[model samples]
Target: MASSSYFEDSSNELTCAICLQLFEEPVTLCCGHSFCSSCLENYWESREESTACLCPNCREVFPQKPKLQKNVILARLVEQMKLREGEGSHSVGGQAEGKDGEGDVTVNRMVNVGGHESHCEVCNEEAAMRCVPYETVCCERHMKPPKHKGHNLVEPEMKVEDPGCTEHGNSIHFYCKDDESLVSLLCKAEHQDHEVVPVEVAVAEFKGILAAKYPPLVESIKQVGSQIQQVHQEVRDTQVSGREKEERLEGERREMYRAVDEKVNHMKRWLSERQSVKLSHLEHQRANLQQEMDSLCEEESTLKASLKELEAVSFLEGYKDLLCRLESRSHFSTTEPAPPRLLDFPVEEQNVDSLIQINDNLLKEIQNGRTPSLDPNSAHRRIKISRDLRMATRTETDNPYPDHPDRFDRYPQVLSSESFSSGRHYWEVDVRSRGRWLIGICLNSMGRKGRGKECMLGGNPESWCLQKCENKYYTVHNNRGTLLSVPGDPERFGFLLDCEEGELTCLEDSRVLHVFRGNFMDPVKPAIGVYGDDGDSVRFCHLFMISFIPFCS
Candidate 1:
């Protein structure tokens, strides 16, 4: 039998006596014994009974079946023991059960007589008792437990060794591809050239590239500036060309305007000349008409005088017939021969015959007027008498011998002659108490004389003359000391010749002349004249004529 102390010690083991380990499934037996429940049930099952009871250590038995009773105190004691063992393992080199013994050895030991014993089979010696409370253990060669199979383990070496390049079969000492500098590793060797770099050298090379390219860019910009200037010059040239064309066109326009102005002025001058010529022609026609009108007026005056004389002759004849009738009536009635009947008288018949004879002789004289053979002596006498009568009539009509007005000391007079016979004649006439007049003459009656009629005449018969006078006795002789016929009644030739301070005289004919005073080119006094016929030896026997005298200032 085991002693009470032995039983108490066994109880304190805190392990299952049936399994000889800690109580995983604790149970109570019928004999008031405690054991692992699984161990007790297994023993009951092997016996093939509904109920069983037994003492594990004492072998006591019970007739009734056993009920399970939790062993609270024993479970508390196991939990406490696990805690103490975990603490002890952590402090003592992390061992849960203990350290292993080296070498294969066996040991045997008897705890007591008739007691449970343990022995090592290898060394055959008493085994040291152990309780493996935890699940695993590991050694330094495998740093992880066998349960954690995936972890890789490395052994600690004394020094870190450089890895060898796979391509070179030597320690890697070349540049790293990532940083471009020396590195060592088999894994990093493939990317060495790309990663390894020298920081200072790379920075310097980049700056040099930028500097070398600068001048070319500046030169390119300068070339572009030159091109822009050339474009501006081209534009200026075009502008200048446009201005020159405009100036040329303006000059042409001005020249065209001047040409038009000159043409217009020439036309104006031509028109003015044409108008002047027309005016001159009109004036000439007017002057010729005026001269014809004056001639007609003189003829009208002569016709009127002839009609008045005829009327007077008719009245005188009527008076004579009336006187004869009265005388016959008073002496008649006693047959005293009827007092010589006037109706039968020869006086009336004789008068009629005489009138007829006069008419016939006038007609005959007019027809044979130029014949030289019929009664030459009487013709000569008749011519002399007619000349004398004409002289007297002219002198009377002109009033040459009239009573002088109270204003005149000696009356001034002008005499013009148509004819004077051949001789040199000189005479002096008193014009005023203070002045004397002289008359000189040269006679050339016939053309046979040394003085030809042509020589004596100075100009056209409408133009020539001589003078002898002061203001009065101013005379012009057309036939002075020459045999020149008198012109017709309405036409005469002569001039009143006078001496002025300065004058010009132009003789136009034997009896016609013009006198001008002052400059010959610009005459201040202008006069023309005509002459009447009278015999030689007659003093102042010319007919007086009046003409217009221009007033001089």
Candidate 2:
């Protein structure tokens, strides 16, 4: 406590956690928390658990009684505190004893209340009040001395008196307003040319300055708070919109599955009904055959009964009847039952042309879309960009453009200033002048630097590309390459990106070469990469419609 302010500033660090007072003999535990040695010993003894002594602060257990070692640094600070406390009390008590009785009371009252080393220096008793002018503390009975009579006094809690100047060792009664510093009698001589004011007047002036700025500062805080609230509302709306879209898509998908399931159930019912009808027809045919056999058997029985009636006359008479019946029956014709008809299985052929036309329609819808602009900041140093920033060309050397962090340092690459977060977009690049080049849509996360950078288009998972090399062309994604067997090398190629469907299609000379279905990881921009110099450049055609010259307005 070189000053009471010093102890006040570091009070938390000096105080023991258990005793709640300044440390007497500071010691450190193995777990790194320091506490008073006697307090720590009592804390452990209260538990009586020696196998694991949990730290009071961190609650971390140590295997055994950590040899409590004296914290040399903290011990020194405690000793210093003791010395400084005595010095502070001596200095303040001496100053107060030389002053009025009321001042003496103030000093002693504060000394006891603030944990100073001693009480009032004159009477060695508790102080009740302060002497404002003489800056001292004294008991009420001691305020009636000849030197203390008629002196102004206030409670010690007010602490209105200022500590004397350290340089001149004189009581501070004035404030130099120009320098904004406190000064005693001898120190005021140096500030004679400066504007000096009473200490109370200077405090009032400073208070007015602070008071003037409060309203504006509060208003600024309110303005910032309002803007933050607006941003929060907007972000909430976006989150709600995205969630709604996902829910709607799920509902629609379930509905489609339900429709397909219902169709399959209907077909099963129809098949069951058709099978029953065929079975019923076979049953009727079987019954008709049985009835014909029964009739034949009945006729034979009647003829046999007539044969048993053996009278010659009767036999002769029946003979003609039998013969006539036989002749008539022999001339009669009988029809056989027709076989049951076969039921045909209902099978429908898929339309190959219609199935193949899905990508065609998607291409048409995606082609008429978002406009793109070349980002100069993304262009490589060796690549020269047009004045309007719509075109990029390879130059002999680096251009005089200012460097940017987003610029491509390793590859001859550039990205469009505009990016697509949602919806469909299409662009065709004209690389007729260059022999080798690459064109693709890349994620904004595509790396700007490093070997095999994702921004190298076809080289990494962050992007996909349809690259051309000499007379051949290939599709690449996630560092894997696929060669395309094209009819011819098409310098003019088109790229269609469907963000919602997560599809990327490449069109070469009015024919689609490939379709990549990997979903994008983030908002994406159209990217261009080429290897050409001086006499060669890659041009972007202005088009917004499928199978048509791109028209940019």
Candidate 3:
């Protein structure tokens, strides 16, 4: 209260008579009365071309346009008074009545301020307080004017502007439910048909509803969190159980390997012992047969000796000796036990050996394989077919062959003259260089003239190929390639086509590379392509039918 009184007393001292507000850049005249520097300057400038300056407040004239030395002490006092007035406004209040005098309410409401002080819109001086209803700041003197009458003089620090109605320029007191907005008193009158309530009543009802629902929302959040924790625990439990199962599986796998090894060893030992016994029995039989043969030879020699003697006395003597000897031999043979019967192994064992022999024959057949010659009519221009038509090589220059409908136009590829519609055919190719190459088969009706996918080997449904490009191996069919895990790069490749079985297999150095299975409804010709200009060449080695004899030695 005392602070307010003190500011009121000092307000007159701080005010500039010309501006009727706090001094801004106050300057003193020779008369010792001060006024705003701009006001004094303007007063002098408005004079009739005078070489003198007059103090607007004191009405005193100067000999010349007095150098307006700023009144530093008066400026300081004005600033101090403005700050005090701002502080006093915060603690003051006024009672005002709403329409129909429903009740008296304090007009002043405290609010926060911005960092810098606001200037009065009327006097252009440091503002003492903000008029909330007017949406402007005013000096202490302007606060008393009828223009700002009944308005709340809040602290100059107040940063938020009152939510006033834009069109009516009135304080919003009621909320229009239809518009869902706070409206001024005049706006409420305009919305008289709309459902409206005081802002305070709306706030109270909303708070009650929010307070009731907030607890359930919080409870639902807790329940969800608990379920999430339970899910995480279950996941951890499953991981532990899986680990345990894997460990047990590993242990069982080891045990199975051990048991297999032991069983194999036992079988090996049993077979070895059985083989030895059979061999021993066969050896004994061989010895007995030899003895029998020797005995026969001796008997024939004795008979010849007897015939040579032929004399009465000699014949009789030899005959008795021969008869005695023969009788002795016969007696010895009869006394000896009979040889054991020769027996073969079980049929299962025989089948195992037979399978091995069949595989061996198949390998031998592959070694003596046959090959097809490259067809000149189907060869690309960039591919030079050998004179014998057995090899196709990529060249920088095109071949001098006449254009044919069956020839390839874009890629350096060639098809074999011979095409197979049925029966299994196996062929080999020599791709001995470190160059890009393809070895596969294609339908005889496949496209041969375009530079598109239909003309490219392995790019159409009519073709399937195993290709080596950039030192990697792939089996491509219908434009899709599958990478192959080859043991090593092989110079020679073998392709076996079983039309009856609908299977085509590719092998390198006797190792199976890949196999493709599909319907061979039409005849397919052997295809070979060398990519690049001069680094690649492929030779058609030979083709032969693979004779598969099952379970035969």
> What lDDT does each candidate get?
0.36, 0.68, 0.71
TM-score of each: 0.19, 0.35, 0.36
Residue 344 of model 2: what lDDT?
53
lDDT (Cα) of model 1: 0.36
Candidate 3 structure lDDT: 0.71
Model 1 lDDT per residue over 207-264, tens place: 4567678889889889998888998998998999778767755764565455446545
- Which stretches in model 1 have alpha-carbon errors above 4 Å? 1-213, 286-553
Model 2: lDDT of residue 195:
71
Residue 483 alpha-carbon offset, candidate 1, angstroms: 81
Per-residue lDDT over 147-188 for candidate 2, one digit per residue giving the tens place of the 0 to 100 score: 321246666556454478989877665788788889876787
| lDDT digits (tens) for residues 171-283 of candidate 3 | 67677778898887777778878876556545655666798999999999999999999999999999997897777667655654664466556557767777787678778
How much does candidate 3 score in TM-score? 0.36
Candidates sorted on lDDT, descending: 3, 2, 1
Candidate 1's clash total is 44
Better of 2 and 3 by lDDT: 3
